[model samples]
Target: MLRGFTPPYTPDGRSSLVPAPPWHYAGTVLSMACPTEPAAAARFLPQGFGRATGRIIAHVCEWQATTDGWELLDPVNAQYREFILLVEAERDGAAVNFCPMIWVDQDISLIRGWLQGWPKKLGQVWMTRSYGLDHPAAAPLRAGTRMGASLAVKDRRLAEAAVTLDGGEGQSLGFLAGPTYGLVGAPSIIGEPTAGALRLVLPGITGRVAGPMASGTAELRFFDAPRDELAALRPTGPAVAAIGNVAITVTGATDMGVVAG
Candidate 1:
């Protein structure tokens, strides 16, 4: 006998809420390329993907982003750094970047990145800004600029990189522009740890190469890393490097597939 009681529901009883606006980020990206063994690189890849060659793309970047949806309001949340170890691989007959390790300086970024299938973890990352000075000798003492980033966990330095930005190079960005995929571990129905592949999709991304190409060296200390997964990137030599600025919208993400336990 229900009388004079109305449920708080619409005619269709469907929720009508709009998704949050995309975040905007502006920053500098310093990149380097290294060669690694095919077998060694394969370990970091998932099913349906194959190593393109033996080249690994490593980069360190510093970014300033808007705090639209971040949980923390601290200044650290507005700015952060990232160190990525990427391997070139083929997926569905096309080349793509397979990210194995990604380190960030903030917890909110780490959590959001993990949900997108990025192998993100908390680490101390730093890089130098562009600077130059005139010298009495040494070719006008014009050192393009020196920048470096290191990943440390609990006072242990896992990786380090040093790069010098000298001048520009006539290289195409299309070759480097592609989709990225990562393996994300999650709890299964039985409460056992399971892993899956997540494909990150960025839409309306627009930007250009802002600075001249760069040359750098990278060193990885597997013994120091927490999981030592980055050891597979045995960087034998340098490939190509560049500096650029970008503005893009993080549309969303999709679960590509599940990894076998």
Candidate 2:
């Protein structure tokens, strides 16, 4: 029998690309939310989902992560950067966020996302970082703090955002509060009659913590790439932005059944 959760299973399970979850992550996030064209939003939803809600939440984050014992012995796998877009949509009459695009800097992270149904690709992500110091270059979290972030694939810029913190309480961010949904599965081969295609609702992330936040006014931009469709969801209005620390844990996913034709 195979000894690990994924392939390359060995007697000790050390060669597996991903360690079995519960995965834990702590990070600083710069987020922007704005309204996208309603029709563009609708085009991204899976069949049977309800109408588009016309908004999108874009985030670029720096993360520290661990899977059980991996933090101490394997610290190299614990750090990564991410950029994700959550498009608002309705499902069965309730609000939910559908992640149509996401990018991460690590191969391990890319595989973890596939397991979770997130369509994650490999990309370069950059964001402003803060430190606790008295120097002008520290980028301290206070009134008038300015932050910027961006993502690129193959040296081509895909998105960019900038925000100026106002030192006010974080807005409720209701549009981003909805549960996130993703499509996970594989396609069947053309001539394989017994081949089965699989699709399931991604597992929910648990133990989420959004730390004390700072709100800001922001601008976001999306650029077209030769092979990417990211520009399709670009917003037409100004964005609301925020900076916050976050922690999340992923346990197991419940099967939500296959999509119908």
Candidate No. with top TM-score: 2
Candidate 2, 133-219: lDDT as tens digits: 767888877888888899999989999987888888766353236677777776666687443544656566888888787888888
C-alpha TM-score for every candidate: 0.72, 0.91
Residue-wise C-alpha lDDT for candidate 1, range 82-134, written one tens digit per residue: 87777788767877787777888866566656655667878887765553335
lDDT at residue 39 of model 2 (Cα atoms) = 94
Q: Report the error of model 1 at residue 84, Å.
A: 1.1
How many clashes show up per model? Answer: 0, 0
Q: Can you give the lDDT of residue 179 in candidate 2? A: 75
- Which predicted model would earn the best lDDT? 2
